[model samples]
Target: MLRIMLRHISLLILTLFILSFFSFSLAYLFPGDPLVNLTGIRDSSEQTYALLAQQYAMNDSLFSQYWHYVNNLFSGNWGLSFSSGLPLAEEISRSLAASVELSAYALIISFVIGLPLGFLSGLRHHKFIDYSLLSASVIGYSIPVFWAALIAILLFSVQLGWFPLSGRISLLYDIPYDTGFILIDILLSDVPDKEFAFQDALRHLVLPSVSIAIVTSTIVLRITRRSVVEVMNSEYIQAAYARGLSPRQVFVRHGIKNALIPILPLLVMQFTTLLTNAMIVETIFSWPGIGNGLIQAIYQRDFPAIRAGMLAVSALVLTFTITSDMVIQIFDPARRRPEDATS
Candidate 1:
């Protein structure tokens, strides 16, 4: 078990190192001077260009620049943004908080709605319920996330006026940015009309959250249904039935527990996917997240922001993948077997 964990950790470190290298090397791969993009200046004196280059350490060799960037990243010094001139770490912190909040809400919604539907579909097998769920899952999976978000805004925000079309909260509230999480900040705040602020924040959250959840839930639903159906056919499940356990009892006590073994790893991967999808979702809803920031950086040609954002996203995905592997090995005893470990 320890060996497997160590191996996974080592692989994770190597993957991160490679990811960082590529992210840094992206500047060199593209044509033209990166400083032009970073500075947003088409014309500058030679001295001014030299100063900007030196300021960003662009004057250094590729290897030296990457070494410094990696060191700065590890030391929590993401450097200043080229456009805004704000500390990149602070910007990332704010954006990351919003993204986390949005993703967390979407994940909760996906599991809450998807799991029961999946369970029913699986229990029913080839029956009407199963077909209905399968159909829905396919349709949901096929819909583009951005289109879904737009439609949600049209119905929920524009026509119905049930939710806000953009932003994380109404401009009406002056909620303190304590934790960078508006929901928590609202609760912890001593602002007047705290309830109103909370409600407004929730309203702003619904459309974008649902947009992401609608797409991601399909994956959970399909996986859960398939896993549950397979688990139901296992010998132990048949034995439980023979021992006079009710169908519901057998399902609740035995089926879901075993089915979850496979579902967990899929869910972990789903988390990373959801974060990646957030880039589009955030842009659509104008949600102030790293995804939104990244898109804006691209448009403005802010290379520092671009590199940092991409690296951050890639590192997050890789970290989650590694963590999920370790968790799966810990929970699934079959994976801990000698043959499994060797394989």
Candidate 2:
């Protein structure tokens, strides 16, 4: 396990380095001059451009620039946004919490609804329940996230008036940004009508979250159903049944444990997907998150903000993937053997 973890960590470091290089390079390669965007004066003098370039390290060689970026990144200096003139880290920090909170809610919804539906579908394979769940999963997976979000807003917010149209919380609550996560900030706040504030935040969260959840849940349901069905049909499962164990006992002891091995890693990938999807969902719903911030940065040609956001998201996805691999090795018995360790 230790060896496996160390290997994964090494791979993670390498992956991040590669991701950073591409993200940084792409920012420069993209059509548009960051200097022009920054100065907002297209006909700036060459001297002015030179001075700005030196100040922002734009005059440096690509390799030197990347070295400085990595060094600054390690030292927790994310540089200043070209447009806002604020630290990139600070801007990202403000939006990161919202994205994290939204993703968390979406994951919770996916698991709560997906797991049981999948399990039962597998148990009753080829029956009505299986067919019904499979059909639902297909529909859920097929629906575009943005389309779903729009429909939800129109139905729930426009016509029904059950949820807020956009934003993380009601403008009525002057909730100070403590953790950037509205729910946590609301709970920690000293404001009156705390319950109302929290409820408002949750109401705003529901539409976007459900949009992400619907797509992710379909993935979870399909994987879970396939895994459970495969495990149930295995020879070992049949032997356990032959030993006179109750159906429930056999399932609890053997079926779920084995089935979960595959499901765990898939769930981790699902989380990564959810984070990426959150960007589109955030934009459509007008939710304040890193995704929305990224879009704004792109529109403004804020190179620093764009690079920082991309690096942060790539690092997060890589971290989750590596962590999930380590967890699977720990829990999945088939991978525990010394011979399988290297593999």
Candidate 3:
């Protein structure tokens, strides 16, 4: 078991190393010089441009640049943004809490809504409940995230005025940016006037979060339903049923557990997809998460911010995949020694 875990960790590290290398390489190979782009008023003479590139060490060998970037990454120094004149690390640090909170809420909402529906659909295959759930999943998955977000805004924010249209909080409130997490900051602050600010922040999060959650939940629900049905037809499940076990007991004890073991990996991969989808939703809703931050950084041509944001997201996805693998190994101990378990 320990050996298997070590091998998994090694593979995870190797995968992340390759990801970081390629990401850095692409940034290096992008069109236009960062120095020239930043200066904006510089002459286009070859010698002057060459001198500027050399000054910023862009003229260094590709291998040297990659090594230096990797080294800076290790030392917790992500460098400065060419446009913002702020440290890349600081900018990400300021915005990260909000993104993390949003992502967490989105994931939680997805699982809370997806898992039970999936299980019920699988258990009641061919019934109205199953058909309705399957149909909803298809529609949910097929809709474009931005379109859904815009529609949601039109319905909830425009026509009904049920939720705020933009921003993380209301303008009338004097909520301090205590931790960049509007809800947490509001709760932690002693300001009496901003007591209701937390609820306002949560209300603002609802539309964008639901837009993201719908897509995320659909994927999980479909996967879970498929996995559960597959597990239900397995020999072990049949044997449990033949032994006169209750349907509920067979499902809860045998079917769902084994079904979830396979679904874990898919859920992990979905995190990155969800985050990528959230980028558009965040912009549409004017939410100040990493997705919106990345778009703004690109518009400003801030290389450091762009690189750091991508790297941070890459790390998050990698972490989720690794954690899922570990959980799978724990739940399905037979995978540790497949031959022995099969015999």
Candidate 4:
């Protein structure tokens, strides 16, 4: 286990190093001037321009500039976005909470909606209910994110007025940004109508989260059904059934546990993807998340912010990949060869 973990850590460091270098390289390869973009000022005086350039080590060679940028990155001076004229590090930090909250909510929604449905569909396997559930999942998977988000906002926000049009909470509540997450910050503060404030945050969260959840859940539903079906057909499951155990008892005692072994990695993968795949929903919903920030950075070609966002995403994926692998190996002891300890 130690050997494997060490290998994963080394690989993670190497991957991040490579990603940082390539993402940093985008600044030089892309069109337009990096110095002007960094400062966000198109018409600075000659002296101010010179001073800004010197400050950012823009006069350095490619290697020197990257080294300087990385040094500053470690020190938290992640530079400024040309679009918003805001510190990239601070923007990323702010966006991180919103993105995390949305992703966590989306994952919760997906699992709550998908897992049971998938389990039921699997047990019924070729029956009407199973087929119907499968069909619904297919439809959910096929819906385009941007289109779904727009339709949701129009119907839920405009016509029904059921949910807020955009933003994390209603403007009426003046909840302090204690933790950047509206719900958490609300709880952490002595705000009036605390329950109401929490509910409003949930209301604002539901539209985008549900929109993303639908697609993710569909995948979860299909994969889980397959896993359950496979596990149900196993010899031990059949033996349990033959021993006069109730179907529910057999499922609870043996089937579901085995079925979950394969699904854990899928759940982790889906959760990791939620962190980055939420860009369109965030943009449409006006959620101030990393996804939204990345989109703005892209439009203005804010290279540093774009690079930072990519690194964040890449790191999320890589970390999750390792986590999934470790979790699987831990859950299924068969993968952990006993001889490895001796070697």
Candidate 5:
């Protein structure tokens, strides 16, 4: 197991090394001078732009600058934003909590609703319940996320007036900043200031969260149903049934554990996908997050913000993938041999 982990870790490092160079180059590949773009120096004298570019080190050769960028990253300097002139780390830190909060809520809802429905759908097989669940899954998977989010807002917020139309919270409320997450802040605070803003933020989150959840839940539902069905036919399951164990007992005790082994990797991958989706959803809802920050950075041609955000997202996704792989090795019968356990 240790060897396997070390091998994966090495591969992860290599992958990131390659990815960092490519991500950096792609941002630099665009036409126009970086400093000129930053300063909007079009129509200025060539000498003026040249001086500023040299001052910002943009006049350095691409290879030299890229090598410096890599060295700085290793030395723990992530660089500064061209847009706000703030440290890239600080900008990302400010937005990270909101992005994580949105993704966490969507993931929780996906698993909670998807897993049980999937299990029932698999257990029922050809029955009406199974058909209904499958149909819902298909619809959920087919709908475009942005379209679904807009429709949800139209129906829930516009027609029904049941939820807030946009933004994280009402401007009127005095929301405490213990944590960047509005919901968490509300939970930890006194009730007096929590009324409008807390509820408003939550209501605003629902459409985007549900839109993300619905799309992602399809993958979970389908994978879970298939895995459960396969587990239901395993030798141990048959033996439990032969011993006159109740259907429910056999399903819970003998089936779920085995079925989930294959599902764990996909579950972890779903969180990464949820984060990507949240980018678009956050923009639509005007919720301030890494996605919005990235967009703003891009428009301003801020290389540091782009690189830092890209690196941050890359690190997070890889971390989840590594975690899932480790979990899989632990639970998977084929991988959990004596040799694996000892290693």
Candidate 6:
């Protein structure tokens, strides 16, 4: 067990090192002068371009600069944004919660709704309901997120006027970004009409969150259906059925947990995917999240913000991957042989 833990830690460390190097290298990959793009100051008036490079340590060797960036990252000094001239870490802190909150809602929507439907479709097997679910999953997975988001905005926001077009809250509420999580901040705030503010925030969340959920949930449904069907076909499940137990009893007692083993890892991967997709969704809906900020950073060539964003995201993905492995190993004790446990 200790050996396995050590191995995971070592791999995580090594992967992070590689990821950090790659993220740092991204800044240097700009086609032309990154400073010029970031600052819009050329060889003409306000030729502080040379000074800017020195200020940001762009004059240093690539290795030296990367080492510095890594040191700063570790020491909680994420440097400054090229565009806003704000602290990169602070900006990320402000944006991180929004992205995470949005993704969390989407993740919940995918799993809460997808799992039951999957189990039902799997149990139904060759029935009409099964085919119907399969078709829906395929169509949901096929649709592009951006296109779906646009349609949602056009139909729901513009035409029906059921939801807001963009932003996390109604413009009427001048609530500060207290915790970055809109709903939470609205509650903690001493503002009047708390219930109204909360409702508006929730309404704003529904469209984008549902759009992402529709896409991500499809994959979850497919994976879960396949896993459940395979588990149902297993000899143990058949034996349970032969013992005169009801199908529901057999599935609840013997099949459900085992079926989860395969989908467990996939679910975590889906969270990572959720975060990735949230970037585009956030940008489209003008969400105040890390995804939107990262998109803007790329457009403006904000090297500090870009590199920091990459590092943070890469680290999160690696962490989630490791966590998923640990969860799987723990969930399926059958994998832990006597010899392995003794070791």
Clashes of each: 0, 0, 0, 0, 1, 0
Model 4 segments beyond 4 Å from truth? Answer: 41-50, 334-343
Better of 3 and 4 by TM-score: 4
In order, the Cα lDDT scores of the candidates are 0.85, 0.85, 0.79, 0.84, 0.80, 0.84
Q: For model 6, how does the per-residue alpha-carbon lDDT over 53-134 read when each residue is reduced to its tens digit?
A: 7755778887777787688788888877878888877888888878888998999999988999999899899999999999
Between candidates 2 and 5, the one scoring higher on TM-score is: 2
Misplaced by over 4 Å in model 5 are 37-63, 74-85, 174-179, 188-192, 195-197, 300-304, 330-343
lDDT of 1 by residue, 134-180 (tens): 99999999999999998988888789888888998888888878998
Q: Which stretches of candidate 1 lie over 4 Å from their true place?
A: 35-60, 336-343
Q: What's the best-to-worst order under TM-score?
A: 1, 4, 2, 6, 5, 3
Error of 2 at 251 (Å): 3.2
TM-score for all models, in order of appearance = 0.92, 0.89, 0.82, 0.91, 0.85, 0.87
lDDT of 5 by residue, 78-186 (tens): 7677767777766787687788888989998999988988898889888998999999999999998889989988899899999888778777776776788889888
**Model 6 ranges off by over 4 Å:** 31-62, 176-179, 333-342
Pairs that collide in candidate 3 are: none
Residue-by-residue lDDT tens digits, candidate 4, 54-117: 9988888988888987898799888777777778778887887789889888899999999999
lDDT tens per residue, model 2, 172-196 = 9899889887899999999999999
Highest-TM-score candidate: 1
For candidate 1, give the lDDT of residue 182. 90
Instruction: For candidate 4, give the lDDT of residue 237.
Output: 95
Candidate 6 is scored at a TM of 0.87
